[model samples]
Target: MMLTKEEERALSGEYGEALSQAMRILVKVGEVLGAERLVPISHAHASGVSYATIGEPGVHWLESLVKGGAKVSVYSTVNPIGFDPYSDIIKVDENFVKGQIRILEAFEKMGFDTSLTCTPYYLREPKPFERLAWGESSAVIYANTVLGAFTNREGGPVAVAAAIAGKIYEAGLQVLENRRTDSRIRLGFRPTDAAEWSAVGYAIGERIGQGIPRLEVPPPPRDHLKYMLAASAASGGLAMMVIEGVTPPKTYLLGEEEKVEIGREDVEHMFGSVEDADLVFHGCPHASLKELVELDNLIKEKVEKEVWVAVAPRLYERANDVIKSLSKKGVKFVRGTCLVVSPIDKMGIRKVATTSAKTYFYLKRRGLDVWLVRLRDVASA
Candidate 1:
């Protein structure tokens, strides 16, 4: 792979050891991926932040980078941690809290925003063709498909490196020719709610696997689109899906792809009832402010069952009044964390019902009985 003089100097340790190490990682990755050269990125979002996800080794790695003088060269943010430091709704051990704090401190020391969200696009909307180095699966797909930004499905460490280097390889989704789809998905029925949207996405992912698909459907609402994108990425390892009218023209190309149709019956069975759930959760991607407000409007009085809503700390602060009102109505706001990353099994949350298929996918793998439900049903229950 070819490197500019500045990149060569950084890789040769002319910069601090931390930056040299970061540059080395990127160059190795670029070579392995057949990248010809490195390109500058506008933003970077690193994942694997949750204490439950990474444990002690991950914490030590971040601390090592920080100690090596690693600092972001571009605007960067981090994924959700194990739990919200500000909220007491989720119970965790003292060790867990201590480990989580250490992880957050390391990222902060390295100049990351510590946004604690999988949905960095919500924090800063990327423009069309903007270059980014984002780690989260859902966020990668969303940025590529919906926002028309250029990025690969980067790993946690690589994303952190990209933040330090302000550059990624000119390969994968960063190359426009690689954005073409060879598969197509046609929705036979319209999704009525967020749950249905998620179900559809999950089904599409299962059918297509990692293949990018051209979606034949009307443009979905922004919130619903997020649910679908999150579920698809969770279920299928999808990095991009070109919507019929939603995706920006010239960003993606449709080929003579094999077609698959999904009907209402195909997805309806995915939505399980909420009758026997121990906990009702929402926001696997972290709820947007609009979603939080909609949830507030859905519940008229205090709910009888335990209901938790995960949101980014910034969004939680912005919608403080709405969150407080929802709290009075028995809605617990989990700031900066979601069921997928939080230690829910340790909390004895066995039977989980949520509006996100992505949440259902992860929690089920953790030996919990997870089911999908509509947002209204979650609020009412």
Candidate 2:
């Protein structure tokens, strides 16, 4: 493999042992995936270092890294840490406040510009033509497809590795060949809304697994496109997949034109039912403020037994006032937690409902009755 002087320098322990070690791994990831070279990223986000998400081990590691006084070579924002309104669950009880504060202090000391939001693309936009290696799966899809930025769904460790190395692959999504549509699946329904894209993305994900698909569907059904991709990724273990028509693949159609059949039954099998749903989850891939504002209205009309909605940190604070007004109703607005990863069953929650096909499958896997319903119906019910 060839190396730029900076790459060779970074590999030679010029950036410290941890960063050097991180670069080696990123190089390996690049090699395995056949990436040509590491591209510079203007802005990036790292996931899985959340104190709340990974529990004790994660928290301890952050503390240690902070104390070690490591340096991050590039500018990056990050997912949430500790308790915030965006997350429904916060790991305050697990860690000593002193330790938690120390970790934050260390990040500050190390000059890591951290913003406690998972969906950093919402916070700070990554422009088209800029290449980034981001961790959070939904964020990667949003950047790749919606914003036309280039990124792969690099995992948490890899994001750290890339950040340390100050580079990630300039190839993959950056290249024309890899970005071309590999297969095609015409949708049965035309999604007139972007929210429904999550379902369509999920349905196609079920059919094609992790491969790219030229999805011919309208962008309707609701709000938030990443929800569908997240649902698909969660069910199928696909970190990142492409929607050819919607993403940056407009001119191309499945590379020489090939047709693939997706059985309605196959897409339907990934979901259960939403008939008597007891819970509604908004943040599979983290809901935007638009979804939260919509949920606020849904709260008034819902008037159900118990409905909890999670939003991003910034959005959660805004919804807090609205939540107070709906005290009489069975609606609760929370954040920093999601139904797919949180403990809903312990809350005496059986029978769940979601517009997200992703959450429906996860809930069903946990032995709960899950209904895959539309968001409009979910708000009314």
Candidate 3:
């Protein structure tokens, strides 16, 4: 593995033994991945720190970085499992809270902002085409694919180390060559619809854990693109994909008339049947302004209804005035909790109905009561 000047210097005992050990691990990782250089990332968001059931490695490593006097830019955002101030969506056990605070306190000390949710894209405001290094599996995929942001599926400590060193090991998605699509899976859907696209992503990702795909779908609605990215990131572990005739090479490389056809049944086989949920959830990746607007529109017509909903802090700020008006009518706007990370039974929420394929899978892994509901149905009810 190639090492940076700073990394070499650390090996020579420049940044102290502890720092050297950390950088040594990074060097080994870079070597294994065949990365040639190091590139500084503008932002970061890490996941797997918020443990509802057991240990949180995210918290452990972050505290170490902070105690070691790690440095990071202020714009960096974090995704973790935590409490929701507004809604009773998640319950943080005492031990989990201690771990969370220790990790976050470290971040705070190191000049990082704790966006503190899985959906950092919705909480931390960044324009399209911005580059960030995120560690959370789904968040990395969501930020890079759906939002058009740049990120590689990096690990938790590497994210902190990237922040501390003001750079990341050039590997996977970081290199332009690595970004090329090695394999392709075609879709018969629309990149325009967030929900359908999300469903397709869920279906495909469940089947192909690490395959880079090219999607061929029908023309879709505006919000559907969000879910397409969300579901794929949620299920497939996909960090990025090129929409056939829409994304870069697929759209640009093919001259006037060149498209491949994939069967619809192929799409169905990607996601297995999931049922038995009690509450409906959206915004697993982070609710965008468009989705929030749709939610506002849906709530206006809701009469005898109560669904556990969570949104991003960044989106919450953008739709503040409107959400304030909606709150008077009865909509629980939660800031820092997700259905997957929350203690459902403690909140007295035994069953959950959701449109998110990612949420459905994660919840089902816990052996909880989760029902799959269409987004449109949740929109009305």
Best by lDDT: 1
Task: Put down candidate 1 lDDT per residue, 290-358, tens digits, no spaces.
Answer: 898898999998899988888889988888799889989988888888888888798888999999999
- Where is model 3 more than 4 Å wrong at Cα? 11-13, 16-21, 53-60, 85-89, 119-131, 146-150, 182-186, 189-193, 218-222, 244-277
Q: lDDT per model, in order?
A: 0.90, 0.62, 0.61
Give the TM-scores of the predictions, in the order they appear.
0.98, 0.81, 0.82
Candidate 3 lDDT (Cα, 0 to 1):
0.61
Model 2, position 55: C-alpha lDDT score = 59
Leading candidate by TM-score = 1
Clashes per prediction?
Answer: 0, 20, 24
- As a TM-score, model 3 comes out at 0.82
Higher-ranked by TM-score: 2 or 3: 3
Ranking by TM-score: 1, 3, 2
As for model 1, its CA RMSD to the true structure in angstroms is 1.0
Per-residue accuracy of model 3 over 227-262 as CA lDDT, tens digit each: 666667776678877664334332112223223444
Shift in Å, residue 275, candidate 3: 13
